[model samples]
Target: MGMLNTLLQAVSSAPIGGAIGAGIAAIGAGIGIGMIGKSACESIARQPEAASDIRGSMILTAAFIEGVCLFAVIAGLLAVLK
Candidate 1:
């Protein structure tokens, strides 16, 4: 238990921890966006006539994912600064 606590403290105290967390979060967001784009492309290829609708949905989903990632970065910054 003591060792675990020490490890936790060390991680929380590291100067680059927050930045690393933010970077990881951004990576996740990027992956999500990539997947969305891939799916959208596949969908359009399968049904060319529905390209517009697929694009619209993909844009909306990407925007939402970006928003969440932005919020997480802000929160991480705030926590680190505090």
Candidate 2:
């Protein structure tokens, strides 16, 4: 019980933990966008004639990912500010 209490207190008092969490979320978003780009490129390369369609779809998907990331960042900021 003592060890559990100590661990809980440490977590509650930790600085930069929120920032660390935000950074991790951002990293995940970056990876997701990178994968989308890679897949789009591969699709375009395999079907040169459909490059336009692939690009359009890719942009839409990337935008949605970016929106989610932005929302997360705003939420993180609000949490920290509060």
Candidate 3:
């Protein structure tokens, strides 16, 4: 019974941890997207003729990163609400 109570207390106090996780996920996503944009721009500058191709691939990669970050945030919300 004592262990059970302790577990419950821990769970109840986990919202802070969940919020931190979400924040970290957001930061990571921002960094990832920024890097992609930076590299794409550099590539385009080096080869203006291939700008179209570089832009297309950059957009796709950024979208994927955003999706993963979204999932992570949702998971964090679930943890906080649990």
Quantify all predictions' global Cα lDDT against the true fold: 0.90, 0.84, 0.95
- Cα lDDT tens digits for candidate 2, 1-82: 9999999887765445656666777988999999999999999999999999999999999999998988877776665555
lDDT at residue 20 of model 1 (Cα atoms): 75
Q: Is candidate 1 or candidate 3 better by TM-score?
A: 3
Supply candidate 3's per-residue lDDT for 6.
100
Q: For residues 1-82, could you state the per-residue lDDT of candidate 1 as single tens digits?
A: 9999999988778646777787888999999999999999999999999999999999999999999999888777776776
Instruction: Give the better candidate number (1 or 3) by lDDT.
Output: 3
lDDT over C-alpha atoms for residue 53 of model 1: 96
Overall local distance difference test of candidate 2: 0.84
Weakest 10 consecutive residues of candidate 3 by summed lDDT: 11-20
Q: What TM-score would candidate 1 get against the native? A: 0.79
- Compare the candidates by TM-score and give the number of the best one: 3
Per-model TM values vs. the true structure: 0.79, 0.78, 0.88
Global CA lDDT computed for model 3? 0.95
